[model samples]
Target chain A: EAAVTQSPRNKVAVTGGKVTLSCNQTNNHNNMYWYRQDTGHGLRLIHYSYGAGSTEKGDIPDGYKASRPSQENFSLILELATPSQTSVYFCASGVRGPDTQYFGPGTRLLVL
Target chain B: GDKVKQSPSALSLQEGTNSALRCNFSIAATTVQWFLQNPRGSLINLFYLVPGTKENGRLKSAFDSKESYSTLHIRDAQLEDSGTYFCAAERNNNNAPRFGAGTKLSVKP
Candidate 1:
């Protein structure tokens, strides 16, 4: 089975703090994505990477940044975290074309 | 208007019954994916299609690019199936996928 793991499953941060969520995939997929899930809004894409060193903005990428340093690792960075950014984050990986995506366990963040 | 809209925002069904969830997309979707979010907040992949149909166990899904829509049908619902069902669409030349608000399903015994 494809495996995707995320670090720091739960987190708490204060406003204006810098937060980083890490993701690792053993599937060897070339595409990686970052998304945030809220109560009313299902899942909104924040950032995605095609390959190493390639990051593209998604629908809601205003307060988030993504980095794909290697084929196995992708990270989402919040330079200045805010209370509004408190939501469940998920990372997914997929191969090229219309293939099934493997998602991580997800990380829940609380900005106080 | 929402780009991806799912019908029946919430649903409740008795065990052994069948139900279908639908998703309509305003975008030109080339592919579709279905996910089930358990009560524990873990999102599990159900089906992925490119204008076709796929069946896995008690779950069956169909996607039509021409109609810009997709549907998921559950047969003999079980308590473990109670959760939120989400459909995501990916347009040609677009790597970012758009997700529907999701249909929350509760299977009662």
Candidate 2:
């Protein structure tokens, strides 16, 4: 089975604070994604990487940035966190598009 | 517009009963994936299909690309199966998947 892990299971940040959520996958998958889950919005993709050193924007890419330094690590960065960004974030890895994706536990962020 | 819509936003079932969850898409979906978000907020992949049906244990899932819909059937529900189920569809190889709002299921003893 694929293993995906996220760091800082819970975070509380002040407005305008810089926050970073880390994700690591052990399956050596080429595709990694970052998503935020809201109460009524389900999951919205923020960013995704096709491979190391590659990042692409998704539906809701504003107020967020992504970095993939290696095949095993992908990170989501919020240079200026806001209350609107307070939601549960998930990380997923897959071998290809439209395929089974393994998701991490999730990170709960509260921006005040 | 909602590209992917899920039916029965919420559901309650008695243990040992059967239920079905459905998702309809407005886009040209080529593949579908189903996931279960547990109470603790872990999303587990249940099935991924390419216009076919797959069964595992008491759960059976079917995806019809031509019909632009998918269904998940759970037989003999258990408390452990209580969670929010989400269905996602991919229009093509280069497109990002669109996710449904999810169906929350509660199995009571």
Candidate 3:
């Protein structure tokens, strides 16, 4: 069974619009991460949350923001969408340290 | 040199054959995790290694922190094993992992 679920399996937004991708996990995991997968590039971490109320910057977090208001939910927000940010986004949840991560079904986004 | 490099960006195998994928880490990785992203786009965890080897069904994995590398072996491959495989490793520094580009495997039955 998948421990994590992501919403808006597919989305399209105009440039400069606000876009948010939501994720929910039933695994009671202490860590959640958002990554973007683009062609020829490995999944780059956009942002991550240590737990409810704790959000941290990841490898590629300049144009993205993450929010974790509750233990079960994590949201990745792109305040001003751009074509460069268009990619497949994935959310993952896992235990505390050095634990295996479980990813949710990806969300494909297009910005024009 | 790349931080993490996986050999053979893609692979094709017969349904009942065997194959091995590899990951070489430039940084001092403390832990490694292997994942299989199915066609439907769900990344399933295959193995998590602190250093050593583990096996599940037809899949086997090995991690050597000293050598900074990991290997995943598939035995008696099946059509259902087709997908992209990824290796993510946590460096010894701040625990951030550098992921390999991935190896896309297509198993024909």
Q: Residue-wise lDDT of candidate 1 within B1-109, one digit each (tens)?
A: 5889998899999999999999999999999999999998888989889989999999999998998899999999999999999999998888778899999999999
Residue A23 miss distance in model 3 (angstroms): 1.1
Local distance difference test values of all predictions, in order: 0.94, 0.93, 0.90
Top-scoring candidate (lDDT): 1
For model 3, the stretches where C-alpha displacement exceeds 4 angstroms are: B92-96
Q: Which one wins by TM-score: 1 or 3? A: 1
| TM of each candidate vs. truth | 0.97, 0.96, 0.94
Cα lDDT of model 3 by residue, B1-109, tens digit? 4788998899999999999999999988999999998898778889999999999999999999999899999999999999999999886645556688999999997
Candidate with the larger lDDT of 2 and 3: 2
Clashing pairs in 2: none
lDDT by residue (tens digit), candidate 1, A4-105: 999999999999999999999998899999999999789999999999999999999998989999999999999999999999999999998868788899
* Window of ten residues with lowest summed lDDT in model 2 chain A: A93-102
Which residues of candidate 1, in runs, are more than 4 Å off? none
Candidate 2 lDDT over B41-109, as tens digits, reads 888889999999999999999999989999999999999999999999877855567789999999999
Worst 10 residues of 3 chain A by lDDT: A93-102
Worst 10 residues of 2 chain B by lDDT: B89-98
**Per-residue alpha-carbon lDDT of candidate 3 for residues A1-112, written as tens digits (9 for 90 to 100):** 5478999999999999999999999978988899999987878888888899999888889989889999999999999999999999999887878678888889999999
DockQ of 1: 0.84
